[model samples]
Target: MKVVVQVKLTPSPEVATALEATLRSCNDAANWLSLRAQDREEDRDRTRKALQSFAYAELKARGLSAQPALHVIRKVADAYSTRKANLKAGNYGRKDSKRYQRIADNPVRFRADAAQSYDDRCLSWQYDAGTVSIWTTAGRIRGVPFVGLPGAVKTLAEYRRGETDLVHRDGIWCLIATCEVPAADLNTEPDGFLGVDLGIANIATTSDEGEPFAGEKLNKYRRRQIRIRAELQARGTRSAKRKLKKRACREARHATHINHVISKRIVAAAERTGRGIGLEDLTGIRERVRFAKPQRVALHSWAFAQLAAFVKYKAARAGVPFVQVDPAYTSQMCSWCGHTEKANRPTQELFACRSCGVVAHADHNAARNIAVRAEHVWAAVNQPHAADTSGAPAASAAPQGSRS
Candidate 1:
C-alpha cells in the first residue's frame, strides 16, 4: 500500500522571488516556442528541446543555474497541441477557449538549479533542525523540507516503483505519492457489497447497509468562495486582481483539504463494513445533459471521480472489493417494485413511485436501489457456471428503473 505525506516548505522571501522569476522565464520560453512552431519549420521535439534550453539559459543568467524539467516543456507543448487539435476538430466552445487562455498564462517551471548534479537537478535544499536537506520540489511547492518525504512512504516497494509526483501551492512544495494494492472482485465474490450514490446536494448517499457521508465542510467553504468571488468581481483594479487570485487560492486549498478528509472517511467506512463497495458508473453524466447555472457549478465541484479513485485504492489496501454498477436508472427505479420512471422522483428531495406508491427520501431511495442492484450482482457472481445459460447475463434480468 502507498500513502502520501506532504509537508509545507518555508522559503525565504529572496528564494521565493528567484523561484517566481524562473517560472516567468519558463512561460516566456513556452510562448516563444508556440509562436515559432506556427511556421512548421521545426519538429515538436525540437521546439520543446529549444524551449527547455532557453529556460535553462534564462535561469543561469539570473544566477540560479537550474536545469529545466522536461515535464514543464512537455506540458506546454501538450497544451499547444490540444489547441491545434480542438481547432481542427471544430470544437470552438467557450470551455475550450477558456482552456487555451489558462495554458497561455502559466509560468515556466524548472527541475532544479543548472549547477546541480544530474540526479539532483530537480531537488531543492531546505534548512531544518540545524542541518541542510535536499528534496525534489519541481511539481509541488515553492519550498519545503525534504526529510518529510521518506516518512510518508508506505513501503520500499513503492519507492522502487517511482510513482511519486511533487506539487507546489501557497509558496510551498510537497510530494504526492501513489501506491498499488490488490483489488477485490465484487462481481464474483463471497462477501457483501455496498452501493453508493454520489450527488451535488448530498455529496454521497450509501445503501442503508452503509451510512451516508456528506461534504458539509466543503459546501461551507464553497459558499465562502462565492461571497469572495462576488466581492472580487465588483472591484476593478490591479489590487483587485491580486485579491481575486488570493481568494482563488484560498478556495482551492480549502477544497483540496476537504476532499482529502472526505476520502479518508469513505475509505474508513469501507474498511469497517468489510464488504466490497459498489458505486454508480457515472463516467459521462456531464456530457449527457445540461443543468441550471448553479446546478452545473455544483455538479462540477462535487469531485465524484476523486472519491471513486480514493475508495478504489483504499479498498485494495484493506482487501475489500470495489466495483462499479450501471448507474443509468439506479436513482429513478423503485426499490420496492423495480419500476423505473422519471415521475418516481416527484420532487428534489423526495421519491414517490407512481406505480407502487413507494415513497422515501430521494437520496435514501436511490441508495436502496443501488444496494439492490449490488445484491443482484453479488448473487449472479456467486451462482455456478452450470447455472449460466448465456455467455453473459441478460440486461432484462438485472433490476432496472430509478426515480431520481
Candidate 2:
C-alpha cells in the first residue's frame, strides 16, 4: 500500500546550475568509461570505478548528499551486463538503435543518497526550473516556490493504504497516484467467474460483459507517434537527431497520461462490481508473440504488465480478490459450454460457441470467463474463513502481498 508523491521542484538559478552540473558529471563518467573500455588502455572495471568516485565527489561538492560511488558503479555495471547480453543475443541492431547500443556499452551513470531535505531519502532531479523545485520522498518535501503542488499530496495514512509509484520521463516528472475511496456496495453479486483477455486490438475484454474499456484515444495517439517516427526517419540529419529525442519525450508523456487514465477506469469498474479480477498468466508472452514483429511491438507498447500491476494494487486496496489463471485455453475455450478448442474462436471478433451456440464478441466472452474463474478461486481459498457481512476480509486482513 505504500505510495510516493512526486512534487515538482522549483529551484533557483544557482540550484538549477548545480543540478545540471551533477547530471552532466554522471553522463560524462559514462562517456569516459566507454572511451576507456574501447581503448583497452585501462582495466574496464577499474576505469568505471574511478569515474563513479568522481561523480560521487561532484555530488558532495554540490552540498547534495548522494550514495557512495560504488553503489552507482554496481548499478551501471549490472545494466551494462544485461544490455551486453541482449546485444549478443542479436535481438537488438547496432546502427539502427545507436542509443541503446551506447547504453549497452556503458551502463553506470548516477546514484542516490539519503538527504534530510527529502525526508532522508535519495534525492534526484532533472529539468529543474530556476524558480520552482520538485522532489520526492516517503513524505512531502517542503520549502519550494510553486503555484502550490501540481497535484494533491496524499497524507501518510492514505499513502500507506493505497498503491502508488513515482516514475520519471522526458525531464518532466510525475507522481502516479492511486486513491481508492470506498464505492457504493454492488447490487448484484458476481454469479460466477469472469475471464479477462488482454491484447493489442481492444486493450481489455471481459467474459459475457462487453469491453469495459478500449484504448481508442490511445490509438489516435499512436497515429501521431507513427507520423513522428516517419518524420524522424525521413530526415536522418543532426537536426533530426535532436527532434528524435524530443519526439521520444513527447511520446512518453502522452503514453503515461493515457495509461494513468485507463488504469484508473479499469480498476474502478472491477471494484464497483465487487468481483475478483482475472488476468492471463502472461508468463513469457513476449517470447510467444515474437513471430509477428508488428504485433510484438504493439503488445510491448501497450504495457499490459503496468496495467496488471495497477489492477493488483487497486484490488488490494479495495479488499477485492485477483487471480492469474492459465492463459492457454482462456481464449480458446468456449465460455458457454467449456468447449476448450482453438476453433471456437474462428475469427478475431466472432465467438460462436459451437456447443452452446452462444454468439458474442470473442474478447468479451473471454473476459466473462476469466472473472468467473477468479470467483471460484476466491471461494476455494477463503471458504474456510467466515465471510464478514461487508463481504470483505476481516479487520485483521493480512498485508497485500506482491506478485514477485
Candidate 3:
C-alpha cells in the first residue's frame, strides 16, 4: 500500500525564493502545454510522448532544466487525463449541458505556485539531519531542514518511495513524500463482520453496539467556516480571497486529521476482536441523495469517500478484511427481523420495527443489517466458484410488515 507523509520545509529566504520561482515556471509551462494537449488528450498513450518531445526544448529555453521540464510535461498530460476521466464520469453534468461543455472546451489551468513533483534526481532526503538537497531555479539548495514528528520522520526514512511533491500553501513550503508500506495478510476466517454505517451527524456507527463516532465538534466548526466563507466571498477583496484560501486549507487539514483518527480507532477495534470491517457501498451517494437548500451545504461538506478510503487503507494495514456491501434499504430494514417498510424509520434517529416491536437507534440498526449482508457477500466472493453459498447469511428486503 502507498501512503503520503508531509513534512514542513524551513528554507532560507534565498532558497524559498528560488523554490517559488521553480514552481511558477513549472506551472506556467504546464498551462502552455495544456492548451496544446487538451485537443489530443483523449489519446493519452499517443500524446504523452509527443508532448514531451515537442515541449521539452521550449521548457529548457524558459529556464527549466532537463528533468523539471519533463516533469512539467507529464504533469500537464496527467491533468488532461484526469479531466477526461471526470468528464466521462459525468462529474460536470451531461454532455449536452453548459457546465459540461465549458469544462470540456477549456484548457486545464494551474496556479502559479501549484505543487510540483520532484524525483530522486531533483530531490534527496536526509532524515537523520532533517534536511533535504533539492534542485531549484537558482541551482541546487542543500541542507534545507524539514520539520516532522520523530516517529513520522523515522517512518519516512525507512519506507519513503517514489517522487515527492513540493507544495507552497499559504506562505508555507512542504514536501509530501509517498511511502510504500506492506499490507498485512487478509484475515480470511474473521470472527465476524463489524458493520459501520457512515453519516453526517454521527460520522460512523458500528454494529457491535459501540458508541457512535459523532462529529459534533466538526459540524460546529464547519458551520462557522461556512458563515465566515460567505462573509469573505461577499467582501470581494484581495485580502478576503487570501483569507478564504487559508480558511479552506485549515478546514481540510482538520477534516483529514479527524478522518485519520476515526479510521485508526475503527480498524484497531476490528483487528483486536478479529472481525472484518464492513462499510456501505456509498458510491455516488451525493448525486443520489436529495436534500433541501438549507441542508445541502452541511450534507455535502463532509467527505464520505475520504473517510471510507481512510478506513479501507488502515484496515488493510491491520490485517483486517474490509468490504463494502450493498446499501439499498438498509435504513428502513429491521435487523431483528427482515421486515422492510418505510414506516420502520419514522424519523432519522429512531427505528421502531412494527413487526418485531423492537426499538433501536436508526444508524445502529442499519449497521447491524450491513453486518449481516457483509457476511453473505464476503462468503460468496471468497469461496470457490462452484462452492454453494446456500447457507450464507441472507435477508429479504421486501417490505413485509405487521400492517400487511
Candidate 4:
C-alpha cells in the first residue's frame, strides 16, 4: 500500500529566500523545456531521451545543478503525456471542439510555485529531530525544522521511499513523501458484511442498526460559505479575492476532516465486528444524473469520491474484506422480502415494504440491501470455477486479486 505523509517546513528567512529562488529557477527551466517539448512533438519525436539529449547540457549551463534539470525535463514530458492521454480519453470532447483544440495547441507551462520532485540524493529526512536537509540553489540547507503528525512522521521514517515533492500552496511550504506501507491480509470467509450507503442528506448510513452520519452541519457550513463568496464577489476587490481563496481552502479542509473521521469510524466498526465492508459502486454517478442549478450546487459541493477513497484505503489497511456491488435498486428493493417498488419508500426517511410489512429507515433499508448483494457478489467471485457466478441476482463485484 502506498500512502503520502506531508510535513510543513519552518525555515529561516534566508532559507526561505533560497527555496523560493530554487523553485523559480527550476520552473523557469521547465517552461523553457516545455517549448522544446512542443517542438519535438510537432516533429513526431517527443521521447524523453530526445529532449534530454538536446536540452540537458544547456539546462546545466543555465544554472540548474543536475538532478533538478533532469527532473524539469521529465516533468514537462509527463505533462505532455497526461495531455495526450486526456485527449485520447475524450475528456475535452471531440477533435473539432474548441476545448480539445485549445489544449492541443497550448504548450505545458509550470508556475513558479509549482511542486518540484526531489530524490533521496537531494532531500534527506531527520525524523527523530523533526528536521530535514534539502538541496537548494543556495546549497544544501540543513536543520530545516518541520512538523507533522507523530504517526505520519513515524511512518515516513520507517517506510518512506521514492521521491518527495516540495509543494508551495497558499504561501505554505510542505514536503509530501511517499511511503510503502504493508497492507494486512484480507479477511476471507467473513461472517457478514457491514453495509454503507453514502448520500448528501446523510453522509454515510450503516446497516448495523443504522449509524447515520448526518450532513446537516456540513450543508449549513457550505451555505454560509456560498453566501460569503457571493458577498466577496460583489466587492470585486483584491482583499475579497484573497479572502475567497482562504475561505475555499478552509471549507475544503473542514469537509476533508469530517470525511476522515467518518471513514475511520466505519472501518473500525467493520474490523471489530468480524465482518466485511460493502459499498455501492457509484462510478459515473454525476454524469448519469442531472439536476437543477440549485440542486447541482448542493450535489457537487461535497467530496463523494474522497470519502469513498478514504473508506477503501482504511478498510484495506485494517484487513477488512471489502466489496462494491451494483447499486441499481438498493433503495427501492426491500431487504426483508426482496420486494421492488417505488411506493415502498413513502418518504425520504421512511421505507415501508409492502410485501414483508417491514418498516425501516430508508437509508438503513438501502444499506441492508447493499450488504446482501455484496455478500452474494463476494461469494460468487470467490467460488470455484465450476460454481455458477450468474446465480446471484443483481450482484457483481469489481475484479480483484484474492488478497484485494
Candidate 5:
C-alpha cells in the first residue's frame, strides 16, 4: 500500500528564494517541452528523449539540475499523451479549447527523486535537530525543519524513502513524500459482514452496532459555507474573491478531517467484530435520484465519494475486507421480509414493513439489507453451485421474510 505524508518545510530567507527560483526555472522548462511535443505530434518516447537532449544544455546552464529537468519533461510528455489518447478514445470532444489553453498555461511541478536529488536520504526523526537537507539550484540547503509529521509517517520513515514533491500553496511550502507500506494480510474470510449506509442526514449507519454518526453539524457547516460563498460571489470585489478562495481551502480541509474521523470509526466498528465491511455502491447516484433544486444542490455537494474512499483505505490498512454492493432496493425493501414496495418506507426515518410488521429506522434497515446482500454475494462467489440451483445469485434473489 502507498500513502502520501505532507510535511511543512520551514526554510531560511536565502533558501526560500532559491527554492522559488528553481521552481520557476523547472516550470518554464516544462512549458517549453509541452509546446514542442504538441507541435511535433510524433511518438511519445521518441519525442521525450529528443526534447530532453535538446533542452539539457540550456537547463543545466540555468542551474535547474539534470534529474529535475528530466522529471519536468516526463511530466509534460505524459500529460500530452493522455490528452491525445482521450481524444482518440472519443472521451474528449474536438471543441476542447479550454483544456488546450489550460495545458498551455500549466505551472511548474518540482519533483525530487529519492535517488537522484536527495541521494536516498530520507527525513529523520531528528528533524527538530535541523539536520535534514535538500538540493537546490543555489546548492544544498541544510538544517531544514519539518513540522507535523504524523505517527504513520514517522513509522514509514524507517523504511525506504520514495520520491517527494515540493509544493507551494498559499505562501507556504510543503514536501509531500510518497511512502510504501506493507499490505495488511486480509486473507481471513470474514465470518459476517457489517453494512454501512452513507447519507447526508446520518454520515454513516452501521448494521452491527453503535449510534449512527450524525451529520447535522457537518450539514449546518456546509450550508453556512454555501451562503457565505454565494454572498462573496455576488459582491464580485477583489477582496471578496480573495475571501472566496480562502473559504474554499478552509472548507476542503475541514471536510477532509470530518470524513477521516467518520470513516475511521466505521472501520473500527467492523474491525472489532471480526467482520468485513459492506457499503452501498452509490456511483452515479445523483443522476439516478430526482429531487427539487435545493435538495439537488445539497445532494451534489455531499462528499459520499470522499467518505467511502477514506473508509476503504482505512479498512484495508486494518485488514478488514471492504465490499460495495448494488444499492438497488436496499432502501425500499424490508430487511426482515422479502417484501419490496415504496410503501415500506412511509417516512424518511421510519421504516415499517406492511407484510412482516417489522419496524426499524429506515437507514438501519437499508444497512442491514446491504450487509445481507454482501454476505450473499460472498457465498455465491465462494460456492457457485449454491447459486446454480436457483439459476440466480443469492443476493439478487427477492428477499423472502425470515423463515421461522
Candidate 6:
C-alpha cells in the first residue's frame, strides 16, 4: 500500500530562496514544454526529447536539477493527453471547453512534485537527528530541521524511502513523503459485511453495532462559514477578500480532518469484526437528482465524494474489502422484504414499508440494504457455484432486517 505522510520543514533563509528558485525554474520549463508539445501534437516523443536536450544545459546553469525538468515534461504530457481524451469524448461542446482551449493556448503551470524532483543521490534524512539533507538550486541544503514526525512516518522511513513532494502553501514549507507499506492479511472469506450509508444529516450509519456518526456539527459549521463568506463578499473590500481566502482554507482543512477521522473509524470497525465494508456507488449523483435552490446548495457542498475517497484509501490500507453497489433503490426499497416503493420513504428520517409493515430509521434501512447487496455481490464473485440445499445462492440467506 502507498500512503503519504506530511512533515513540516523549517528551512534557513538561503535554503528557502534556493527552494523557491528551483520551483520557479521547474514551472518555466513545464510551460515551455507545454507550448512546444501543442505545436508538435503529432510527434510527442520527438518534441519531448528535443526540449529536454535543449533545456538541459540552460537549466543546469540556473542551478536547477535535471530530474525536475524531466518531471515537468511528463506532467505537461499528461495534461495534454487528458485534454485530448476529453476532446475525443465530445466534451469539447461543454462550457469547460473554453478552459481547455485556454490551456492549449497558454503555458501549463507546474506544481512542485516533491517526489519526482527529489534527487535520491543528494537527499538524505536523519530521523534520529531530526534533520533532512536536500538538493536545491543554490546547492545542497544540509541539516534542514523538520518537526512532527508521526510514528507511522518513522516506521515507513525504516522500511524504505520513496519520493517526497516539497510543497509551499500559505507561507509554510512541508514535505509530503510517499511511502510503501506491506499489504495486510485480508479476510478474503469475510464472515459478513458492515454497510455504511453516507448522507448530510447522518454522515455515516453502519449496518452493524454502534450509533450513527452524526453530521449535525459539521453541517452547522459549514452553514456558519457560508453565512460569513456571504457577508464578507458583500463588503467587497481588500481585507474582506483576504479573510475570505483564509476562511476557505480553514474550512477545507477542518472538513478534511473530519473525513479522515470518520473514515478511519469506519474502516477500523469493519476490520475489528473481520467483515468487509459496503458503500453506495454515488457517482454522478448531482446530475441524477434535482432539488430546490437551498437544498441544491447543500447537496452541492456536501463532501460525499471526499468522504468516499477517504474511506476507500483507509479500507485498502487495512486490507478490508470495500464494495460499492448501485444506489438506485437502496434508499427507497424496503430492506426487510425487498419491497420497492417511493411511498416506503415518505419522510427523510422515517422509512415505513407498506408491504411488510416494517418501520425503521431511513438511513439505517438503507445501510442494511447496502450490506445485503454487498453480500450478494461477494457471493456472486467468490462463490458462484455454492448453493444451499434449496438450490439457491448462499447469499439469499443474508439476514433481512433493518439492523442487520
Candidates in order have lDDT scores of 0.57, 0.53, 0.85, 0.84, 0.71, 0.74
Sort by lDDT, best first.
3, 4, 6, 5, 1, 2
RMSD of each: 6.8, 10.1, 3.9, 5.4, 4.6, 3.7
Off by over 4 Å in 5: 43-47, 89-91, 94-131, 383-404
* Quality of model 5 by C-alpha lDDT: 0.71
Least well predicted 10-residue stretch by lDDT in candidate 6: 387-396
Give the per-residue lDDT of model 1 (tens digit) for 192-223.
55667888777777765343565465567676
lDDT of 6 at 151: 75
Q: Over the stretch 1-404, how does candidate 5's per-residue lDDT look in tens digits?
A: 77667777788788879777767766766666665665664655435677787777776776666677767666776666676676566554444677654543443232332112233442333543633577677776777776764684465466436666777777787777667766688936797889998876777888854578855777788789889988999999999999999988887788788888889888888888889988998899887888888777677766889999888888888999888888888888877655788998898877888776767788888888888877777667766666332212233434333322
Worst 10 residues of 4 by lDDT: 395-404
How well does each candidate superpose onto the true structure, as a TM-score? 0.68, 0.64, 0.89, 0.93, 0.85, 0.87
lDDT by residue (tens digit), candidate 2, 298-365: 67666677767776665666655667865656667665556667787888777776555567677776
lDDT string for model 6 (1-404, tens) is 76667788899887888878767767766666666665664645434566676666765665556666566656666766776677667666654678656754654455653223464665778887888998776777889988864775575466555566778877778877767767677678887888899876778888764678856777788789888989999999999999998988887788788888889999999998899998988899889988778777777766789999989888887889888877767888777677788999889888888776777888988888888788877777778786222211233334444541
Angstrom error of the Cα, residue 111, model 5: value is: 14
Order of candidate numbers by TM-score, starting with the best: 4, 3, 6, 5, 1, 2
Tens-digit lDDT track of model 4 for 252-367: 88889999999999999999988999888888888997877876787787888898889999998999988887777788887766678999888877888776567778888788
Clashing pairs in 5: 338-399
Best-matching candidate per lDDT? 3
Can you give the lDDT of residue 71 in candidate 1? 46
lDDT at position 199, candidate 1: 80
| Candidate 3 global TM-score | 0.89
Candidate 1 local accuracy as lDDT? 0.57
- By summed lDDT, the worst window of 10 consecutive residues in model 5 runs over 108-117
Q: State the lDDT of candidate 3 residue by residue for 295-349, as single tens digits.
A: 7888777788999999999998889999998888888888876688899999878
